[model samples]
Target chain A: MGRHEFLESVAVADCAVEIEGDDLDDLFATAARALAEVMVDPATVPATVERSLELTAPSLDLLLYDWLSELIYVKDSEQLVFPVVEVHVTGGSPCRLTARLAGGPIDRTTTALRADAKAVTFHQFVLEPRERGWRARVVIDI
Target chain B: MKTLPVGDCVWEIPPGEKPGMRVPARIYASEALLARMDEGVFDQVTNVACLPGIVRAALCMPDGHWGYGFPIGGVAAFRADTGVISPGGIGFDINCGMRVLRTSLTEAEVRPKLAQLVDALFAAVPSGVGSKGFVRLSGDEFDEVMREGARWCVRRGYGWPEDLDATEGGGCLPGADPDQVSQRAVTRGRDQLGTLGSGNHYLEVQVVPPGGIHDPRVAKVFGIEQPGQILVMLHCGSRGFGHQIGTDYLRRFDQVMRGYGIVVRDRELACAPFGSPEGRAYFGAMLAAANSAFANRQLITHRVREVMGRVFGRDPRDLGLGVIYDVCHNTAKLERHTVDGEPLELVVHRKGATRSFGPGAPDVPAAYREVGQPVIIGGSMETGSALLVGTAHAMTETFGSTAHGAGRSMSRTQAKRRVWGEALIKQLGERGIVVRAASKSGVAEEAGFAYKDLGEVVDVVDRLDISRRVVSLVPIGNIKG
Candidate 1:
């Protein structure tokens, strides 16, 4: 299934989660797609544009926040919406991520941002590895 | 979704729910109301429970909603001895609140010209994103306004001392130190004073509903409807200035937090010791922002009074457009409250909450001491709002606090998708409620359905004994950003 379908399928009341390929790259890619699920018609976000992302952090959870925040910046500033199509996770204890993103012609019709999350708060934020893959539980400040 | 019985209407969040919790979170809601609560709200409150320096418990009100740091309906008291003040707790729009005005005009006179009055108000009130005002000020002048609060507006002839009497702390906190405020805040605030910034901010015309008041004497004192008497209520805040102050403080707090060994549950909850230099600076700047917000509302009142006079062909004073009560929803005030029977100076941070000083409280104005401080809760314009009075329970339970409004239920995107602004406006107009909006999008963003039911929210407060209902108000006209 496409990233959009995965996001829609995993939907919780206020959040959604997804598990993808067995690498850090794919994990970060899926995470971006999850956030995209909130902002627009995720299906419409194409892999037309490719961009490289790099983030280093002291903690794996903080790394995840920086990753999501990076994608948000790209979406908000560059108007590029992407369903993270690729991923690669590296580094120890505190992880680093490298990924590929795609999208184009940002949907101008999306007037109200899904949620203007104020910040990525540390409250109840956790990143854990499950039997199937990796999972993250982070609360966005809204 | 599980409930643990606490007092009459309180529910506890058992300590083991989240391992990191410093204290069990409690909610003030009836069983019936709790059943309908969105599960995300529970999760959010749980997150709040994990924050550091969270003394007592992370409390959520009946109006609780998912928010940045603390739930919109959340309340937590930190220990002054070893506590922190989070900007996320007070919200970005510091001191965003409501001001209710009592008018002599009966519902009879306002009904005829409600539409025109609403339109006039819409035009006069600057709203929407990046909305500016005609009363521009230089940076230096803006600094004075920030320091003085509503007194600045009153000094400029926007209002009188009587208005101050009805406002919290006479519309200005003494700790406001303009020098603590950054230049960016001053720039954003200079021209935004006297303007109603957008997103849930509005000017509403209301009529006290029939048979809504339990006390005829109290109703008469508050100028309640004899079936159709009219009142004006406005909700807004310090605008760009407040937003900038919040942003600046959050960064400063984040940088210095480690030095103070203040480990907050959330970075959004970043704070310094109340007595620390950083904390004092934030308090000073926050006070300035609160004062600026007070001045903003004060000026809006003057403008509304002007428009009312012109629209009705009667002087506003003659029409009894007197200030009833103005209260702040987001602020941290240094006050002495009895904690376990010992009086101590504490920095009370109220976010998405309003102070409801009970009758006879020394902090309350002498004029209102007998009746209790009026608590004006502004519901979304298309929904019903309420007027309540502080109860002794407030002082004992929630630190003299109560919910501010119908907390948001849906995200703006969801609301925009589900409700069209044009259709919503038409529906309201058909219902005899005239609405004037800065933009169609703004209207949709603030649709009543976008919020939790105010009736339900008010019921929780009344049932919980935090505040007692004084009257219910039905909207007649609306002016929104």
Candidate 2:
């Protein structure tokens, strides 16, 4: 199944995405994929290198913001795009995120960067339980 | 949602209009422009009015639009002793601003070679997403740039020392602590000193069309001697460095706001009191990022001169290329202002507004103090831009602030759906404007129609006596990222 889908949000001047999964861990993984898709064409980037990161925030919503923001920071600073993602969330008063990102250095010859996703905004950001599973929504500042 | 007419081209949202609003919110816009403004702008402005220690009313310029927290083109001042500082107020692109340089050559002299000149510029100036810059600074050198700004560029032989005199705050804001900036931000900015990033950033070659000078006296003071004279306008900012700083601080403030007993309506408006340790640290880091921006623009200016020199077969100085002025649109500066019939020191936050000090103001450069500071308004590539001067009226009403640009009326996605990049390129070509862009999608996103009419926006400010138009420049060529 597809990890995530794009959503229309006029409230933000930039793009938004909705990720669906069976649990919190799945939701984080899907959210990471959605973030990567916003920056570059997913099919073009090969999962040649793997990197792992851990982040902690006070709540699930903030954990999502931190996770996505870290991706942007990695892309801009290291010029790499992640196509494969694995996320695990440990639920507590202080939420912690462990993510494994797999991608390669941006080769301008083949990889076409669609948008420069500057940061992950907190505007209307949400991660919650749904009737069927877990759902997350994030608006990116492009 | 109710608005009361205050004065010519002005409307006010009374303090009571919104719960928690401590002061009134005023907007400068004509009837037509007001109607087109997004309803969210009112909410954002009112929300800003509720911030702790905000002085006067939260003011939105004619170009105001709904942004993340504060509306773009929003200006507000707060008492330094009690106010809170929010990175959102200054925006992610710290010191994102405009700079204009005039050349002795005229439109007629350069029209034939416009394509070649644009190509040269496009190559000389690195642009677009993931683009690296020409200057690769060592860690120590990068720290110096954070502390010194344009002055560092001048010392490195990238710009003339005199250029600093023509810049806002002399191109460097004091209290920049390089140690406050994170290592990640430093790494991101190390190779991006002279780069132009994507999304609404561009370097345009423009001309002052015949009879475009609005005020002869002001134009003379601005070094604009004749109509049809060529000028270069570059719009960019602190790049990755500023974005990282803003991102880092927003998260930090969001966590600490609870500790300070501060509650903001929006998380994006997260802040800490000015006297708090977190607030001082963010301010210091923000200044460092702002300095990096000044140095970035200065380096680009140097590159522009180098390219022009090569293309025209003359020395850059021989071509009479000199900076008119460089001003920031997004910043928070510690300034003194008169409020409630008393002089007070405050921190003025201009999100998407420019500082427009009036004639005889101490901040205005000595050469142009009699006329006033130049307020650069960059419009779309297809339309044109305007040069305006600050007025005394602005100082009293708006903390000496003015609109930055023709605010976006359509989202980037909507704009792309409405216009085809190839077709727009052809249309601009027919209008005698040459454009070189790295991405076709970016070109489509920045279609001229996406923004409100600059003429109407500028007119509102002019009628309100916030700023007076000096000259209008029509674009002949542009290089977009």
Candidate 3:
């Protein structure tokens, strides 16, 4: 299992979160959940709707960055708030990722939103491994 | 970094203070403001000084704070022929700005219905996360909006012709090649037009108390004619369309800058020469997004008018609900300015800053030429906002720019922890401000205590003669996203 928490004082007018996971797949999946939490409580989303995503990036870090950005893109283009994220990553210099997402259309009446996050920023972005697990810090422009 | 007092409300960090700095950096702030700024402000502004082809000096206004690459309130200019353009300098929300509308009705007449008006606005103008606006545009229509800006809105009956006159750049930036805009960007922004996105975006109904008029003569010219006059002020930006474009260009710049032999202190400051193919494409796309933002504000203005008209049972024009001014922050422009008495065409970037062209500049509208351009500074919901006029001094001192808002002193998470939304709403209601919001967390995140005192920020710019205060407006009702 992976975990995430919001950090204060990192961004003047945005959200910064730290996530930890058991492995690469866990980290990527947890990152999606954390990004979704920035907007609404995932527990309220019910995981009733499902979607799939596939992406390839030159590097693992860029892979994670684009994965989070894809969530924002989906929120805007598809008008979906994904609460559940499952990930499978293949190791290589060019990383490959396939994600399964579950959520539904955004309705103000059903889900209480916290903020309209603009983009996932590269300001002080860090994704690295600690002694026992992996740790990532991301800043989101709200 | 060593900083010395260089001028009135001005501080300078010399190039010798850091390696690779092409020019010194300047910050417009009083001693108190400097003390309150984060230590990161020095690092961020100094990092900006190291960028290629930077001109005169890198500048951070009184409201400066740490941003992705360029600090908020950051201003820098580069020579067009030899310079670079970075998406970080313009911000993710392209053309994020302020718009003010003046009403002929008095506060006494509107006070009884303030709550109703706020509620109506909250309902009519779609706001908050994932709330789509009423607009539905096809691909062709949306492209027209990308090129025509607010003019498209007016042609489709969203606004009046005269409204464009009061808008900056007449509500459009020319040479907007929609072909340069990405299909993904269009998909994100097409239907989002007219939405007031959450996180500090808000629409407020305010009043000009008799004693709050600072410049009586100029106030009358800009439509703040009578005491107790009610006004509407909104703060928002281009939404997801601009975000996608900015994200797209920023990533591309990061990948291409090395090929151009440009090295930036931060990845977010990545750039290519303004003459390069990459840069030109980005400029075109950015202009398109900026145009979309102008149209977004205009359409929102239409919604405000409709809501106000229904509440008052009068024609919007009959209520004298005309645009006073619309000014954008987080933008870049090509302008002619003189440095050392030498005329130069420069690409000026203003992120979390406002352009304050002087009275005689051709850019200032005919109606405001004598008093200078109107600069609107939005404050916290509790402290209120102000309408100022640009000064000749700003043109010479700070590249025709000034501070945009009261800089945040605390982050949103900290504010939410300190103040519960429901209680804050109750407390504000007791103080006569009617509050309507999409979510309680949204309200708490924007707690007034999280922001710096608006008066102090205004006083610094005022004392520097950059922009002079004209009228102060306190919020009577607010629709927060």
- lDDT tens digits by residue: candidate 2, A1-142: 4367665434435676778888888888888788877777789888898998999988888888888888888887888888798888987989999888899877766776566777776655778888877887776766
lDDT per residue (tens digit) for residues B177-295 in model 2: 98888898887767888988877789999999889998999998888988989999999999989998999999899889999898888778899998799999999999999999999
Q: Which segments of candidate 3 are over 4 A away from where they belong? A: none
Instruction: Sort every candidate by DockQ, greatest first.
Output: 3, 2, 1
Chain B superposition TM-score per model: 0.96, 0.99, 0.99
Note each model's CA RMSD in angstroms.
6.1, 1.7, 1.1
**By DockQ thresholds, what CAPRI class is model 3?**
medium
Write down the TM-score for model 3.
Answer: 0.98
Off by over 4 Å in 1: A1-142, B50-53
Q: Would you list the C-alpha lDDT of every candidate in the order shown?
A: 0.74, 0.87, 0.90
Reference-based TM-score of each model: 0.80, 0.97, 0.98
lDDT of 3 by residue, B60-131 (tens): 999888777889899999988899898989999999999999999998999898888998999999888887
Which residue pairs show collisions in model 3? none
How well does each candidate reproduce the native contacts, as fnat?
Answer: 0.06, 0.32, 0.70
Models sorted by lDDT, best on top = 3, 2, 1
